[model samples]
Target: MIAHPNGTISTEVSDFLLNCLVRSSSWNFWLSLFLSFLFLLAMGANGVLLVTIWLEVSLHEPMYYLLSILSLLDIVVCLTVIPKVLAIFWFDFKSISFYACFLQMYIMNCFLAMESCTFMVMAYDRYVAICHPLRYPSVITDQFVAKAAVFILARNGILTVPIPILSSRLHYCGKNVIENCICASMSVSKLSCDDITINRLYQFAV
Candidate 1:
């Protein structure tokens, strides 16, 4: 239902997309199955990495601590997303509920932002370690890393909270099918028969 810039409204496109997905042949199923299996396997490997990090006392330095955080984030992220995606491939319930869809988007966005921020902070640490070797120990302390992690999480949490809350309040009429693999904000807004200028603007801002 997105209102085009030309003052035209987008027709409900979910049914058409759903039909196409439904009609996907055996090859599509196999491809999806293989990919989902690979994703799950990757998650398992990350879990092993996490366990190894925990068991090794020598891996308690700032860099390994960051790696552990990364492992934890990877585990959480895959846990959040991969299961549902795999279910869609195996189960019959392909459609995600509106609230669930938005929630997924919100969580996914929060994690993505946090990951970006964490990597950026890690890069800053590396820069300090390389470019200013003398002050690196004083500058990138454990407290600083903890603070940076907290800041990253808090910033993303604050910025992403409004998305689900605001998008959930928007009118959707009868359109409920999502075309993409996941129910993203853009796709959901596109289902509306109302003006989605605000949604698009917010999406761009995010």
Candidate 2:
């Protein structure tokens, strides 16, 4: 581990092995199979929903657009974390490259935040539609959706970038086992050899 001038640490670990649940138990096989089925079901359902919205012009409204965004976010979050988890559980392939781990961490944090923002905007849409029915049309337009999309992207996209970057800068001497299905920010940071006060505080604030 090397200390930096900015009071951060850096490590040179090539990869990490995830400490998946039930690694040696007989139930691992059945759990992996069930998770695989759920993964496929989620992907298929989200894909069909997106395609249906695209094809049907009647459903081409702002609400459907937000739902589509939410679906897309869910698909991404699932894809980001599940395949590797299944590989770990089924084939014992738990080695994730250092950079890949950080990438996964970034995607999980950013997309989840974006999903939350989408829900908040959806709530606002419902409020306008129910509480102020007449002005809803003028208030919520295509332009408003476009702006909200931009806000979601810009807000969460920028805010979550630091998580992976900070984690990458930490020094890891030997402990490279992540005790979770996904490369969560706190889980990964706990393996660092340096102080993670900032990481913990930032995660809490987020």
Candidate 3:
């Protein structure tokens, strides 16, 4: 339940309305179709790349392994934000449940961070392979790749957990309309009546 700024305790808010950028009815229709098509194309390409990498034994090296992880992360990111965005654009289905919103926010933050970390690890792998050719085989082993994957998961998963938890704890006494495509941490935090200084700073830190 949200306690209004005027001291009235309102019923628990089950969902939040997402105020998507819909300029006009016709615009929304065309935009949604285009976005949906793009999403499908992206997913299909990534899926094929993943399958090919899995099937071909020659592509089972550290570079291709990291590329596969990147593809998986891309697929996850697209799935996390694009479906709801398409629904909002097409049917004006903007209402997202409170817990669902938090879940989406957490996933977006964590996955993006993990993706960035993956890129860094990939860069380091390339650097070692090129800068020190002889030692590359020993340095960039399958065990090293496995450890990198685990570190990426652990670092992002644990660090980004607090973002949603902190936002969920805020007293959202004001309007519940989020003016964005996704349930971003700052977007949700700004709707709260309580102090959001910590939320902002923590998000910046992350």
Candidate 4:
């Protein structure tokens, strides 16, 4: 439910209309084509990398584990954002359901943070391998990678879960048009009929 300062609570949130350029414009047509090409390229590259990492026994090491995690994160991000963007651009279908928008927000936030954490872990793995070669075998083992996986999930899940929760509690009784191709947190929050300073600060701190 959305609470308003005037002692009114509403459960009638409307679907958010995503903003895109005029579908008839030649520029938009070219732009959409370009975006589609990039999306396909990215997906193909990441999918191949992920499959290779999964099937190759020689690549079953700590560094490759982190690499595969990065690939999965990339795939998740692409799948979450590209399809909706293409829908908006190609078919002029821009409305996104309320709960689905929040779900997208959560996935974007969580996976993005996970990618950064995975990169950090990868860096540490390389550091241990290069600086402490003899100890690398014992220090960065399969168990260490497993623990790092848990750490990434736990840390990002705790930090990112509140973004949608806090965003949903705000009153959005007016202007449901989201001035972006995707359900970006800022685009959605800006339409709420309430103060969003807390949301902004919390997202920035995260």
Candidate 5:
């Protein structure tokens, strides 16, 4: 996939993730079952980890606290797309409504971006604590961490709103059927019959 200076294209990351989400029919029903089972196992493990961390006072340190947050985000990410993805694979939902697609796209992007920012903040925390132990307490306070988490969520959340708003406003003239498994920005953009020259230019610029 191509990379840019500021950020990589959404489709590139989504494409890669979708590939991991899907499996070939050659893998057989049993293998698919086993893989799904394993996914369920991991989800259960994370749930247990969250409960243990929450219920046990000893597990409430900064590192574990961040880990708990990460685990919760992980579960949200999986829940966001996996069900629709599995439905597409097992059942039949060839066409998703524009509204549903937009909602999914925005939400998936918001949570994913939030997780990325959270990881970056966690890295900075580790660096401060390990590299400058004496000053770590002053540098990373409880309020500071709370604000950091809110900043990550708010930053990602605000950026996602425009994507859906822009996409939903477009009028699809021709074949509404999406070429890909999921409703991607490019796929949706390509379906629009209205003047999209500006949109295309902006997309390329991004």
Candidate 6:
């Protein structure tokens, strides 16, 4: 039970309603449809890129491996976020269960950082090829790409696991309305009755 301002108590929160981006007007609903179409397009393109890279042995170098990794990240991000956004806007299926919300929080946090690191490595790959062309083949090998992939996963997973855990440990106190389309750390933490400054600081530090 959770205490209220007037000496009352309420049951614990079990689920959260995902809010639409624009609930104030019905006319803006079409924008959600448009954005949903764009997400679908992006996912399709990335899917094709991944398939092509996997099928073509000639594209098995560091550059294409890094590109495929970025494509994989895009697909994951779209899969995690776009479907729920579409559901909220089209079908009004806004209620996300408590555990599911936190799970989404973890995946979103982890994969986004991985995607950024992948991009950074990709830029470095290009830098090596253009500036240090003589040593490019030695420095940016298939094994180097593999190690980078492992590092991205390990680093991001270790760092971001704490985000959802820390947020979930807070006292939600029966508040269940999430003010964002996605289960972002800040949005979820703000629903808690306890202090969330630590969450904010950790998120910023990461």
TM-score of 2: 0.92
Q: Quote the positional error of residue 123 for candidate 5 in Å.
A: 0.5
Q: How many backbone clashes does candidate 5 have?
A: 0
Query: How are the candidates ranked when ordered by TM-score, highest leading?
Result: 3, 6, 2, 4, 1, 5
Error of 2 at 136 (Å): 1.1
Task: Give per-residue CA lDDT, model 1, range 45-157, as digits (tens).
Answer: 88888888889988766777777777777777777777766666666456666567777889887888787887888898899989999998899888887888788878999
**Candidate 1 Cα errors over 4 Å, as ranges:** 1-23
Query: For all the candidates, what are their Cα RMSDs to the real structure?
Result: 4.6, 3.4, 1.6, 2.7, 9.1, 1.8
- What TM-score does candidate 3 reach? 0.94
Best by lDDT: 3
**Per-residue C-alpha lDDT of model 6 across residues 1-206, encoded as one tens digit per residue:** 87778998867788889886576446447877798789989988998999999999998888999999999888888899988888877778999998999999999999999999999999999999999999998999989999999999999999999999999898887668888889999999999888899999999999
Tens-place lDDT digits, model 4, residues 125-153 = 98998999999999999999999999999
lDDT of 3: 0.92
Across residues 32-56, which tens digit of lDDT does each residue of candidate 5 receive? 4765786698699899999999999
TM-score for each predicted model, relative to the true structure: 0.84, 0.92, 0.94, 0.90, 0.77, 0.93
Q: How well does model 4 score by local distance difference test?
A: 0.88
| Candidate that scores best on TM-score | 3
Query: In lDDT terms, how accurate is model 1?
Result: 0.73
Which segments of candidate 5 are over 4 A away from where they belong? 1-35, 195-206
Worst 10 residues of 6 by lDDT: 20-29
Clashes of each: 3, 0, 0, 0, 0, 0
RMSD score of candidate 6 (Å): 1.8
